[model samples]
Target: EAGVVQSPRYKIIEKKQPVAFWCNPISGHNTLYWYRQNLGQGPELLIRYENEEAVDDSQLPKDRFSAERLKGVDSTLKIQPAELGDSAVYLCASSFGRGRSNNEQFFGPGTRLTVL
Candidate 1:
């Protein structure tokens, strides 16, 4: 089955540089999510969107991270002045809706970023 698709499976950049990751969700899915996973930790939610509106982004670092979902299909996550601590796997996920019973999300392969 076709699932969420993400580009640039890996990225390497300087600490102060900027980086971006893209994601394309499954057809007809209306909710999307961005997550960050460190070396030994589980994926942490960075942002969540219901269509084009960001319904949950409290965990996102507003000073350095920004995300957008255009036309509610494809989404992009960007990080400016990427810090060494920002080196992690960026994951993208999508689901049919945000209801409690319909929250099962399909995840992408993820973009692994390495900041030096």
Candidate 2:
């Protein structure tokens, strides 16, 4: 019955350091997603997980960014050797998988990352 949950609502790190964020989707939700929001831009989908499989991740930066959803539940996103450009709000969202009439996504308060 709980909404999505995310941790460390704010994070600050020097450039080139590594940063990680976590999220727990709503119970019974079959889909989860990770998104990045740069200042003045709308959130862009980084990855989408249907159950435990990553159904889409073309926008994710494989060079320094990675993510995983374990056992089809909680998920984590990591950015290694962070860059100043990587500073943004990392949002997590969930919803019932596609094919349903009411598959509206529910979003969590994003983890704000600052690269100094």
Candidate 3:
């Protein structure tokens, strides 16, 4: 089985600029999640998708952040007009079940965004 994949492991952008990240979940996994980890902080769920439907997205900042999982196999997160405070690690995780517990999630290394 393949592990999760992400591109541009690091990014640097000016405030108010736009940035985007990509992720490809593990094969056969039915649940995918996007999380944000501020420096020295644990990951906070940004959005979660079960198959094709977005099960959770309340934590996402609609003002400048957006995400999508078109085929339920891969996802992308975009930040338009990025803010300096948006600098953080964007992680993509996947699981076999949709439960909110340990072991279910296998996290990617994360895309580290540095807003200047």
Maximum-TM-score candidate: 1
lDDT of 3 by residue, 1-116 (tens): 67989887999999999999999999988899999999999999999999878888999999999898989889999999999999999999998877564547888889999999
Model 3 segments more than 4 A misplaced: 99-103
What lDDT score belongs to each candidate, Candidate 1 first?
A: 0.93, 0.92, 0.91
Local accuracy of candidate 2 as per-residue lDDT tens digits, 38-71? 9989999999899888888899999999999879
Task: Name the lDDT value of residue 33 in candidate 3.
Answer: 91
What TM-score fits each model? 0.95, 0.94, 0.94
lDDT of 3 at 44: 99
Q: Judging by lDDT, tell me the better candidate of 2 and 3.
A: 2
- What is candidate 3's local distance difference test score? 0.91
TM-score of structure candidate 2: 0.94
Estimate the lDDT of model 1.
0.93
lDDT order of candidates, best first?
1, 2, 3
Clashing pairs in 2: none
Model 3: pairs clashing at backbone N, Cα or C within 3 Å: none
